[model samples]
Target: MVVDTEPRMLKHQVVRKSLDSLLEGMSPGDPFPSERDLADAHDVSRETLRQAIRELLVAGRIERRGRTTVVAAPKVVLPLAIGSYTEAAREKGMSATRILVGWSTYSADAELAELLHIDTGAPVVQLERVFTTDDTRVGLETTRIPADRIPGLIETFDYRTSLYAELRTRGIIFGPVVDTIETVLPDAREAALLTVDTRTPMFLLNRTSYDDQGVPIEQRRSLYRGDRMTFTAVMGA
Candidate 1:
């Protein structure tokens, strides 16, 4: 059962907690307990149970898809500091899967060449993926790694748990990223995966990640759902 802190944050904390208990680790499309059964177990009215379920749906904790309320994997955090997506998700008790869309060795296009600080025709490894939580696609990412600096990285690192963690273990440190964030319309495929309409605005984040020597190592473009996700940051002088 996913018991996030402050169930009281929503109106029906008791009912929500009960439902969370029932849905934990259950597969998508599994039958949620009947309304009467849930009401009996939680000692609440059926209307209250329905209200709690709606809140869970909004929080992306449990989906009210076709047949049942499916438990969702935990959300990911995009820290202002450097962190790995897989590590962050695992820390919150969720599994992280990386799909290697594939790699390429090609001439850099104008904008990409500028972003990666590489000469045109430089070899690059392009990685693409959709990040999921409990089988629900939450974000889409495309990352480009400059090929010269890290040859054969894909052979070992493909589908690794956390790319940034592995890089650190290899004595590679990434400096702070310079990122630009905007909201834009999702394309057809993105809309389908994110379960939103194409017209619904999605967050577009373009980031250039560098190394200690001020050499760009990774260029990344990410799209997140505005409705289902939020990011947190901390800054201090």
Candidate 2:
């Protein structure tokens, strides 16, 4: 809702920011002050406070909890495997927002060229991103796409969309992935970006996606929050 800057606008801004913080799940149901207390703190009239609360209720951002109120939304649980990040996120009704921190062509180092089965110094597009769940940052990924094969990648869609789908439309495929993961200590940048302090660790998943002809098309490294994610892998006897 585009709220106009009316005479009673400060209270609305306070409510909006507070509701957004609530949806971030910082507090479950223990945060919203009472009607009278909020009115006192914000220096607004009780009627004004009531109106702001009503707006939040209409927006579905909060609900009554016991005698008080609590945030209404929960983080989504997106299942991952076999499909692309965008695919898994979309399947679970997430918006799949991406912040493209890095996007450029690099000459593949020896290790990278070997992984993609290309000559050393072949052009590769590297993309680093943080993906969010409900506008809250949840995961970080650094991916490399071999350039000659994916030709003109930047000219096409926005960097944040489903690259796998785009590639399929161009008759390219990364058939299935072989992945491994380990619990890792977060570097400073990763910790800051993922909203985890140094004391908290992340699960680092390194994946190599291959084509039907056994060619590697993309290699990705992702760091996911340890508290928010669980992995379920089927086993073969």
Candidate 3:
């Protein structure tokens, strides 16, 4: 067994370990013991117990549900590769769906023109979608596609299905993608839409997908709940 001995043990660390052990006997959504009871049982001060609980909350091991603390569902692992969110959820034995929060078509401004490598004022379809896994809202995605490449996409596309799947049907296959991630906090509007507090941490991901000829096919920005999602990468030699 591996042991963490690098950092000298702190008072809160001791309590956190004990609480982690207690959680092994518990299941997701199970109510955690009251703070007072946990402090007494762990022989720690209330402040120390709260500190430990705070650590667990940040680590995604536990979460606040209404006014009670409960064991959090295991974070969904997203592969850092060219695949859709639907595939990732499916691998975790969960159902994936999305709600189209917004959709519009507009001329590609300078920023969009640079990202999509298109001329300024080119038509682009902008899609706003909220991704849900097992009934939990986990991510918000905004996708932009050059309208001229995929004719009639706005009229024929199904908002409920995977965007990648729809693109494949129209002969647009993603070859390689570049993804960047940043840690950020949500704004009031984002918080309300995600059903999370403004203080909740989020993973902001910007991705650009390209076709075989090195043409940018799609540009997407997605925000994922840090408490409910994790990323994994595969390295090759």
Candidate 4:
């Protein structure tokens, strides 16, 4: 008697293999075939195809642009260190450009006041900017600084230039910083600005930079595109 006991591959695995075959012929930013088409072509269930596509998205092999999925560019690796975004991109041989989106002085809210160690209602400068590499927008950075700490900052400082360099020239020095990283989805406005879908995942970094005396000088919230950027860190053993 002949027994047929060979284990068959899982449906999602088969779908993944088919998708790999499809990707072999595609270039970065090239739109992938529609989900229904892929499912039919692979002879797999729609759920299985979606699972495979989600895996690809998580692995950074593909990204969703509006309603279509496309091959993604290699992620730009950035070291988790204290430095300017411009300098970091330059180290990787990419031209970094900063565009100042807006700036205004406002009364610190409860949360902002606590983060900056200032009293609520104290004046704070809110600065928003976008960072791009090779003309591709990659990150959005919003910073809040105690207005009393940087006199004439709103009127005299060039918001389009390197803020850290400007602060250094003004005798403001950086000390230790506390940073936290999280994953988030872009809001509608952020999606429009980053040219990504609202559901696209991103890296949100919250950092508080301190002065030499350990006083908080600035609180920064930065959103980086997950498909376009990666963060690395080196630890001593």
Candidate 5:
């Protein structure tokens, strides 16, 4: 015997349609009505309304800021390419800004040496910066490069601008880069820098770049706010 599934499906569809209609009339960062009020207006149970809201949260249409839920800005689509983050934001019609937090030169530890293909105890330059679009903090990036590779880079180059451009001028163009992406919860320091709660999820991107001669040039670690960024990849057979 076939079971009747139309009623349950109809409830879900109706709840989704109602929420979608509500969203169409709301602007980004606008407060959403209370669940009880929305349920009453949609003539659906509270559970049904909650399920619809959960779907919207997963779709990045809404977010919880502090204690209230509000409409979310469109997720910035980050392409998987070897390019400057500033250039990427410009392509999306957004102005990108970089704030240098600090920089220093240090002796490479074993792990840093392995990542940059340098000798342990050799000098390396470490630079930290926060990336923003307009006034919204989007990401935090830390990069390490062998000091010997780019002499005077720490003193001569402006950390607020694109490092790739400066490296290009010095004939250190990138040939290939390997990227690994993972989801992580921010630590207290990271949360403070990104202006998000420690419990908020983030995307951790670790990348290593090599020069034309297969020499590792730089290793970068970037943490992007999950609520503000989405990654897209193109795959082929």
Candidate 6:
């Protein structure tokens, strides 16, 4: 005789494990099995199978494609350090590119002045760009820098080049940076720009980078697709 004292796995949990295996062998963009078909194959009710599918959806292993579900591409992992987004994508074996969407000069408001350690009404250049990885839209970033700091930046710098690299060419050396991250819902404009559902959660990151002399270099705000982007950090005691 054998004894089994452990609690049995829930039906949905069991189904989820099986589905994970199926996803492992599936290619990105491949259609996921329909709910009815999955239920029949797993010998479970549609509602039960749905619970399992929902988990995968939230985990970014699958995504909604019109009326069907499809396997999703792997998420891009960003390190919690001062570096280039393109470099991070390359480390993950993904191609990274950016498009300049908005660029202009504006006077710093009270909040922006405080963050940039400049007087209110100081002129600053703002650059808005969208980033893509492996042909998938991944994030939008807006960077503001004091206009006087990077003279001729608007006319001389190439938007397609790395912003950090451009700064280096202008004799700007990066120092320590402060970063803040949060989960948020994008507004209509942002959702449309990213081609994501308004209800989809996003990761918002605000960063202020300093120059080697401890002067503020740039203030940047970035919104990353929750399903397509992830962040990693190294901690020491």
Tell me the whole-model lDDT of each prediction, alpha carbons only. 0.71, 0.74, 0.89, 0.87, 0.87, 0.90
Give the Cα error of residue 49 in candidate 3, in Å. Answer: 3.2
Winner of 1 and 5 under lDDT: 5
Worst 10 residues of 5 by lDDT: 5-14
**Could you give candidate 1's per-residue lDDT for residues 130-199 as a string of tens digits?**
7775555677888888887777777777554666776677788777789898988899987876665575
lDDT sort, best first: 6, 3, 4, 5, 2, 1
Predicted model with the maximum TM-score = 3
Candidates 2 and 5, the one with greater lDDT: 5
Candidates' RMSD to native: 8.2, 13.9, 3.5, 4.3, 3.6, 3.7
lDDT of 4 by residue, 89-205 (tens): 888898888888899889998998998999999999989999998788889999999999999888898765788998999898889899999999999999888887787789999
**Model 2 score (lDDT):** 0.74
Best lDDT among the predictions, by candidate number: 6
* C-alpha TM-score for every candidate: 0.66, 0.66, 0.89, 0.84, 0.81, 0.86
Worst 10-residue lDDT window for candidate 2 reads 57-66
* lDDT of candidate 3 over 53-118, digit per residue (tens): 888887889988778888998888888788788777888799998888988999999998999999
List where candidate 1 sits over 4 angstroms from the true fold. Answer: 1-78, 193-196
1-237, model 6: which lDDT tens digit per residue?
888899799999999999999998999999999999999999999999989987887688998867988999887888978878977787878888888888999999999999999999999999998898987777999999999999988898777768898888878889989999999989998887787778777999999999999999999999998888899989789
**Deviating ranges (above 4 Å) for candidate 2:** 1-29, 32-76, 235-237
Least accurate stretch of 10 residues (summed lDDT) in model 4? Answer: 57-66
Alpha-carbon deviation at 137 in model 2, angstroms: 0.8
In what order do the candidates fall by TM-score, top score first?
Answer: 3, 6, 4, 5, 1, 2
Candidate 1 to truth, TM:
0.66
| Local error of candidate 2 at residue 23 (angstroms) | 17
lDDT of 2 by residue, 1-237 (tens): 987677665766776676566467555445566788877877778888787877665454555544766664543455557666666777777676777777878899999899889999999998888877666566899989888887888777676787777878988755778889898878899978876555444679999899889989898999986644555666669
